[model samples]
Target chain A: MITKHLSEVTTKFNPFSKQAKTCRIFLATLPANARQTMKINSKVLPRDTDAKSELKIKFKDGREMQFDPDKHSIKDVAEEVDRHSRVLNRQAELAGS
Target chain B: MSPRLGICRDCLRKIRSPSSSTKRYLAAAAAATATTPAAPPSFEAQPPPIARFPRTQPPSHKPPEFRKSQLHRQYTSLLRSTPLLLLFQHSNLKSQEWVSIRRELSIALSKVDETYPQTPPLADSTKLQIIQAGIFESALRIAEYYKPPPPPSPGDSLATPSSSPESTNATPDPSNPIFTHALSRHAHDAVYKFKNAHPLTPLLSGPLAVLTFPTVSPPHLKAALSILAPDKQAGFPAPTRRASPGYYDGAVQAGVAKMMLLGARVEGRVLDQGGVQWVGGLEGMEGLRAQLVALLGAAGANLVGILEGAGRSVWLTMEGRRGLLEEEEKKE
Candidate 1:
């Protein structure tokens, strides 16, 4: 597992740093190719051609989860991000203590 | 008779045609008729005037007829016999007395209405309504008349500690640490009682308590928290930051605004380490503050901003917390 600084992903999306823990979990759930392209800079990263368009994810907590554009018909990636937000929340709660 | 006899003698001397006696009688008749005019002119000139005796009338007594007066006296005596008026007189109430009286009256009237769901006829209903209205109005007037004395200021207490034991006991004295210590203990007792008797446990279960405590000073927060049993306190994580007055103020202000939005009044005491802080007389304030915290937490805003905007004292600790948290994370 490639471990990256959680701040790198959080700073990119959550400038407030209030949701740093949640952002980390969401980034970790992404495919390696997709996750590598996700940078903290304001500019959007280039899309990868070889990366699978969609993938199912098994969260660290053993929760059943899946994300697919065609078969599952998940249209909005932002919505998908929200769908997995609970994972990040649980993680944050644990880390907060 | 002599005249008549003379006439008769003359008549006899001149007895040639009519006798003298007849002429004398006719002359006498004419003289009598002349003496009394045809029907006295005064009698024909005016008709009789109407006779009017002095117009006397009896005096009128407006209040009551004798029968009614007797009945009223009887009723008054009956009313006097019972201690009804005496029981409810309350004539010599001081300023705060009406607060209790009004509350009692409201409770009594409410009970009456509740017990007698089927009211009497319109007349009786109207009478009761009027009486109730009068009672309410009078109670309100009495309450208005009796204004509570203004809160004694810190300086005022400092000046007159000798005069008032209660005030002296409440006023914190740097020189008398024991007094301050006792006050703090009393405040803790009050807080415990308040929390135990609090009516909004369901709403207060989580975010409410969290937001309320952080807004007050540390000592007050500790005292307030002490009221909650140890087990409950252990359930929630200890706040990362020391209690700061500004943060607590901000939280309270935010909480109040949220409550106001929900159509509730915010109530709670702001206490310091010295003990009982500011005691507000508002009711249902805890519930209101709890509701506000829940709403803000659900909405996901910086709870501090909303609190400050609501005109509560948000201590500098809130700002410091955010900054410190950010700095600590950056170092990592």
Candidate 2:
């Protein structure tokens, strides 16, 4: 793909060339159908990445950015309130599964 | 303006129309002078309005209803006329005649209760009193025929409730607060009444005659327990307490025992039956007192604590050492 884009027609390239590297210039274009497919793929990749970042969150201060995604999940406020919530949950457990 | 030499219309009207009150004063003063004829009635005498209006009593207490109240005022005299126990135990009272006597007694008791008003209490007190009276009868029957349990054999501890005929009678626990409470609706008032009548004699004398009074019942036991029981027994026995072994449990027996000690019913019975050592020609009264002090201690820490306090005060006067009352007085 690099060869087709840069239009390098060399049969062999230097293995140990000491020449200072310069920017390559593109001289060939993709076919119209390949170009359309490449555009669609670029859009799909960003949507998938954004969805992963959205799932990675911390909720300590109501809602917040979670630095360590593996660590925390709940939106806790205070230990006393948390304990009370647990007690209520246990009471509910008595009533049902 | 020469300081307004003329009176205003209001002043003029007040001055002229004071005639009704003025006539009343004149009439009073004239009567005073005309009747006495010793010294002239002072014209500067205060108005009759001051004498006419008596001081008003605070109505914190309910004013007794007419017949009910009249019966209440006469309650002490009524009890005197036909003593309470007499109403129950009159030898001449026929068995079938109980219906008429019950009706009459209920009427009188209802009237007496008008004086001893209770409000927002646990139960209908009249009903509780009837129930208490029934329990009292049961207790009295036991006391009448009670034989101290035969010497305990090896299997005594293994005896279950089902092992004895007594256990079969399993009455509901009479430790009910309602029954207890009905005993003392006017306890505070009764203290003042007794105090006024005979000073401290009544509290001190647990003599045979007084001990024979039918008043010492489960209700009194409940009151004694309230003042005596350890907090573990925790105030009186729980209100929902159910009795085992017919009439009462160990806790209740202990309560009744303490109650008897206070009234010296056991000691008096001992005197009547001749038991223990005698001193000062009193037929073992001291031994009985010591025994009772010990027995009351078994009921609760408070009674023992009181006995200890009295013991510490070697000079504790006769007047100061009212058996049960000393505890009540200390509580106050």
**What's the residue-level lDDT of B76 in candidate 2?**
26
Task: Report, for every candidate in turn, its global Cα lDDT versus the true structure.
Answer: 0.32, 0.29
Q: Would you give me the overall lDDT of model 2? A: 0.29
What is the C-alpha local distance difference test score of candidate 1? 0.32
- For candidate 2, write residues B187-243 as lDDT tens digits: 222233333132112212211112122332223323222322212232344223342
In candidate 1, what are the lDDT values of residues B1-332, reduced to their tens digit? 54756666566666655567888988899999999769977678755433222122111121234554334333323322321110011112222333332332233334334443543211111110001212222222222222223456678767865534332333334333332121123222323333323211211111111112112222222222222111122332222234323223333322221210000112222122112211211212344667888887877766666866655444466777889999999999
Position B272, candidate 1: lDDT: 21
Interface RMSD in angstroms for candidate 1 = 27.1
| CAPRI category for model 2 | incorrect
Model 2 misplaced stretches (Cα beyond 4 Å): A1-97, B1-78, B81-244, B254-332
Q: For each candidate, report its DockQ versus the true two-chain complex.
A: 0.01, 0.01
The residue ranges of model 1 lying beyond 4 angstroms of the native Cα positions read A1-97, B1-183, B199-332
